[model samples]
Target: MPDGYSRSSRRLSILQCVLFCALTGGLAASGIVYDYSRTQELARQRLEHTTDLIAQWIIGAFHASDYLLRDLSGLVDTEILQHPHPDPQAQRRLTERLIEKKDSLPHAFLVGAFDRNCIVTHTNAIVGFDASERSYCRALRDDPSAEVFVTPAYVNNLDRINVTQARRLESEMGDFRGMVAIGVDLDFFSAWLDRIDVGRAGSVTIVDSAGLLLARKPMLPEELGQRVVEPRFLEAFASEDEFSAIAGPSPIDGVVRLFGIRQVPDLPFVVVVGEASRELFSDWFWRAVVSTGMIVLLWLLSVLFLRNHLLLVRQRSQLVRVAHFDPLTGIFNRRHFEHLADLAFKHARRAAVPLSLLLLDLDHFKPINDQHGHATGDRALLAFVEASLSVLRETDLFSRWGGDEFVILIEGDEADARILAQRLRAAWARIELRNDQGAPLSLTASIGIAGTHPAVPGELDSLEKLLAQADAALYREKQANR
Candidate 1:
């Protein structure tokens, strides 16, 4: 019932609303962080899987090449090598044999064989050029057990980047005869890679086991034969099987890329396939934006719903208070006090316990309002109500009966009612208020008490008779004071 309590309640309600908003925002932020982290992990896994598929495709091409080279090698063993003391006709037969097979081996740009004495046979180029000095010839010569040899990227006699796959030839006595070499134009790989889908700015590369550049899409002539010394490949080299990486500054083009690397089976080569990071994560960007937007919307909805519910509850509480209590003094208003009286009177009549009432009036409330302003008058009324409450028991009903007057219904005898009224008067006398000029103002009240005991009262049989006696006594008290 104090002057500032209602304002304090409003402040508390606002504080609760603020805390609710903060808790909702914090939960939304935590969810977004978790979702984004999960998305990034999934994207990286997708990129790694894509890299593996590209590596496998290139490896499959090499597997096909192996079949072609083996078929040519078999022709040499059965036809020329098995013949003892072979003549020029047999050598010519070997060259004709390669010419026939070359059409079927579409990937091979040139197919040829060289005799043990460094003499060439069945070749498309000049026949007199000794091939024994080439890398493929040395590999077969130095390692008799070597099944195949793969050359690094180099400019062939045709002035194009090419590599070779070779196999050793042996006589029926297992004597070293010569080697069969299949020259492959690496542009075949470039053309194949161009047809495959690897997203925007994606590439496939072939490198020797030494990390030497062999071939790549978006081909660079100056980059051929250069060693790939980037950390990503160096790390991959440590792995014997296929692996992948999200790396920076590609050796071929210096663009950041996601890479997949694997050793070519049964060959001295590695293949690296990659896509640019910008293109690879493009989908993730839109997905992240959409997810964040949904989360924010949900957060806002929760806050709005909570605030609306709280406001509804607050409105209900305010309506209940306004219905039951005096707005200014926060005591029971006349209608609510009368409603409670009907119940209290019925119970009292049944119990036969004595009941009492005190009707009090402020001596000069109207003069105070006229002299000082309505604002100060309102403060004075609030102070008087507070002091009266401090003197009354919880069971007693104190109410604003009308302007500048109040009533207290006591659940006791006449003596108890008089004692409570005296305490209320003394307590109110101590209350202080200030006018607009800030001067202290004092107060007093006149009170009349009535009891249910008919033996001592003029008339007190029913509620109406009891109120009449109280009013009559109050008039007499006012006359005596005048």
Candidate 2:
């Protein structure tokens, strides 16, 4: 191949390698992005599922409290509750019933009957406890039609945080009589939640419609019964969506988390399941690191392999050039010339065309080398080759046969060969070489021509025969010149 073509091929290979690596990196980046998005989507799904479950559990707990309070309200005697101080025997009978009913509900802290004045008339726990200041009592009094009320979390007289579910008691005339109330211990939900596998920094929380934290696993004691003020949580609560997933820093603890919030159906509460951002993406982060490392490692290895491949190609190309061309004159050497000439001769013979060979010897070449140094002699030889190349057609095969000797295979007959030989002689005559002293030296050559015509087959049958005839002619021409 030509040097220019070889160089272009190498450049194209490098460009292709660069594009391949770029494409690989692009694919890797896209995969990582997809994985990251998938991780977040999966986390949201899991949180939503967990929130739904917790919401259902809370609903079940509320329903149990509501049912117990409603049942006890029917059993309490309105006549005994009407008096500020009731009959001791009737009140004792009522207290025993309250204790029995409260035992049936596992998480119920207290089950009691209240009079119109919000005075505890019958109780499972403390007697004569006043509950008029409680939110549930006040709510039932203000809204006479409110049959059931659920209050925000508050510290009970027992100093435990609890929420109360109460059923309003009515007289036969539809007048407000009193209420039967049950206090639900927040610890009941917290204990169950603690068994769940929320991650290292994850939490399960229960909040009322007013954003009052009722209960939480991974509990913040100071935050219980306090209103949550996180904007994202408030926004989710205010939204029309019954269930939503949100991400932000928690107002209570300042830890960033992905929160799945679900409003408990028909209950004045919401269940929030929060997964810490760091924990949620912890596995993905390591996968990204390992995947990126592998991609980079593969890219570097590919580049190195391509570099070695290109180097090998370059070295092989150089070896081919050295094997096929003359080191000094940049023309075909005798072995390569003969191989090409043999093919040409065979084609010419088959086609009944003419082929010619010209052998040239540089005259007085030794004397010039003896006087001006081999370097000048080499310059003369290069000049001769350049001159010959200028006069020859591309179809002609010109080569350095040996020292001071050159050969050319022409595609034409003897007459065409003679005309080209004259041109070669004239071109060589025009070349001027300078010795070290800057003295001009003229160059000349003796040319001998031999040819074969298809009409005269016996004259030249092969390249070897043709070369021998051309050598004889060259010897005669040199002797005549001497």
Candidate 3:
């Protein structure tokens, strides 16, 4: 009769959805984690390849400068070695050549040759200054195999951060003449690194073998010449020249990143490329949002569809129950009772079994309803049905036939039916109901039997005939009570 699901049915639907949502949420979380991990791995591989290419470019650039420096040193050695000491014009030409080389190699920070006395030419300002005390010059002047020496980053006489690249010049007799040194500005390398894309939070760094910072893409001036003491960096620093990749929190910005390190061969610095953890997984955020949203959306749809199905099932069951049962007393209603009784009549006729029908009517029911209320009459009716059910056998069918009337069908003869009706009458008297004022209300029932033991055949042929007989008996009983 109702359009919506009943209270009990609604509660069952909600409980089912809650359990389903929990399972769906767990599955969605697992899927997101798996996707996140796979995406992160792919990003790392891309970053590693990127860093590799950048490292090669940096190494090539530094190597180009080294080759030029070595070539310049050789040219100088060829000039002064053949002549013992070059003439003034020859030395001037050598100075001119050095100036030309400097102009041709734009990457060179400073290009000028210094003599054994530590005096630099072509610079003009420091032409007569002592050069032997300079660390790079001293190293070349003392070490025999110091064909090429790269100094750690340091502040030069000009107060600029730079690293010295030098190659020793020798005489034809294999005696050391001097060294040709070039100071490379650390900023130049940082600028070159800046040209590439390392993402918003990414970075590239160059540090000497001693762990001293040489250049960094996100140039932190204070970090220049500072030792990298972070455990991850220290670990990379202590690693062999084969170059290894690592992952951890960065010491520079304190952000986590995946790091790839490669050393420039024949150079004193290592190239370290870092891809920030956030940037590497940047795309995964939106992917996870959309993916999780879709999962949740689907789950919600399933719940809605399933709830609709449950509502339909409950509605159907409610309709069937409403069709067959008395709403107030929860007993079989008149129409359904007659249908069941018709089936029972046929079964009993075929089996030739003893069949009994008892029709019951409550006595003085109209006066109680007029005095107390219809609500009390309903309570009395329900109390009678409950008490009768307790006294009836499981095989007996008891049904509410109409207002103030009921019927019972059992597999028994007239005597047995009479005994059952007497028992029900006595029990029904003891059953009581509370009125609105909390006063106890009791009632009695008049019952009539339809079948007598060893009755003639065809006497109770149909349910209608049996019911007519029971109704006559019930009228007689009511008159007797009056």
Candidate 4:
């Protein structure tokens, strides 16, 4: 109801609004961060599963190739094949067997038998092909302990990239006698991988243990057979984990991706599946944007509601003040004074205590207004109210009863009321008032006292009777003063 109380309430409301917005914003940010982490975790799991599938497929292919090479090695006789010019009938028989075995395996392109000189002795395809410079041929010729070998990807005579899997051939006396080998077309992996989807900017790559790029889908022709030198790739290759995931920029294209790497079982090959980060988290990005917008919008609405609520409270407080107080003197009005007086009268009667009333009339107020104008008269009234308030006790109720007339209700008897009335007169006489013409003015008031005594019976039973007695007393005082 007071200005200070209203201001404090407004400040409290503002503080509450600020705290609410801050808490909401903090929660929204935390939720967005949690969603981002969850998205990344899910993507990592998916890529790891994909790499596992690719590694198993490669293992199956290598297992089939290894079985075919080993079986073919057992059928060939290295001692008889090493002869410079052996029987043509024996060579013809071996070539027919090689063609029959090679046809049974789907992935094997060429199946051949080589002698001690690393020279092809019999073949399923063209003859007289020398494998002396090939890694698998050289390994078998140089190392008697080497039973099986898988070579790195290399360009073959047909200008197509191929990886060879081979088994060492030995004489009955356990002598090194070159090897039996099969060529696996790298296109076999590429063709199968093309059928699988890995997103828009994704890739599937196969590399040898020596870090040589064997094959890749979303292929780069220039990168084939080249060594991969990226540090993350090398780390994954050297790690003990059979399958692991890592994130980094691609060395070939510089696009960032999450990569899942796996080593094929019992083979010198690694499979890597990469998913582009942008494509993987596209949905999450949009969700974050929408979530943030909603949080901000809700906070704004809450603030607006709080502002409107506080404004309404302030307006209601002002209306209450206008209804209960005098605008000119900032004191209680006649109607509010009457209500408080009735309550006081009832309480005093019930408690058997004395209740007193003092009515004041400004003397010669109309003459002052007619001579100096109504503006001076209003100033006189305000000054009188200010002076009276200074003299009155806080427990006393004072009001402007009418124009140039005021009333007060005190808790004491007429004797005590007279003492307060004398003080009011002294304070009012000291007031200095002026008109617009800068002329000094004098103001005075006549007081009337009335009360209900506990010792008296029905002397002042109602407020109307008390007021009538106070008015008659005021008239007698005024006549005596004249």
Order of models, best TM-score first: 2, 4, 3, 1
TM-score of every model?
Answer: 0.69, 0.76, 0.71, 0.74
Question: lDDT of model 3 at residue 372?
Answer: 93
Query: Which 10 consecutive residues of model 2 have the lowest summed lDDT?
Result: 77-86
Show where candidate 2 strays beyond 4 Å: 2-42, 77-162, 168-179, 183-189, 239-243, 246-251, 349-354, 390-395, 413-432, 450-461, 469-482
Report the number of the highest-lDDT candidate: 2
lDDT of 3 by residue, 1-482 (tens): 23234656667777887878887888888888998889766766775676667667767776787788877876674435322334667767877787677666665667767766556754423454566777788888888777778777777777777787887877767667777877777665776676778888888888887788878878798888788888777777767754677888888778898887776666667778888888877787888898789878988797888778776877787787799888898878888888887787767767777789999888889988999999888888878888899899878988888888889998888888989988997888789687889988778888888983223554757777778999999999888888
What is the lDDT, from 0 to 100, of the residue 167 in candidate 4? 88
Runs of candidate 4 exceeding 4 Å displacement: 2-5, 12-31, 78-162, 168-179, 183-185, 209-212, 341-368, 374-396, 408-433, 442-482
The lDDT ranking, best first, is 2, 4, 3, 1
lDDT of 1 by residue, 210-311 (tens): 777867777687877778888668667656765555557686688877776766555566767677778766766666677668767766776686567666
Output the worst ten-in-a-row residue range by lDDT, candidate 3: 77-86
Task: Look at candidate 3 and give me any clashing residue pairs.
Answer: 118-131
Q: What is the clash count for each candidate, in the order shown?
A: 1, 0, 1, 0
Model 2: lDDT equals 0.85
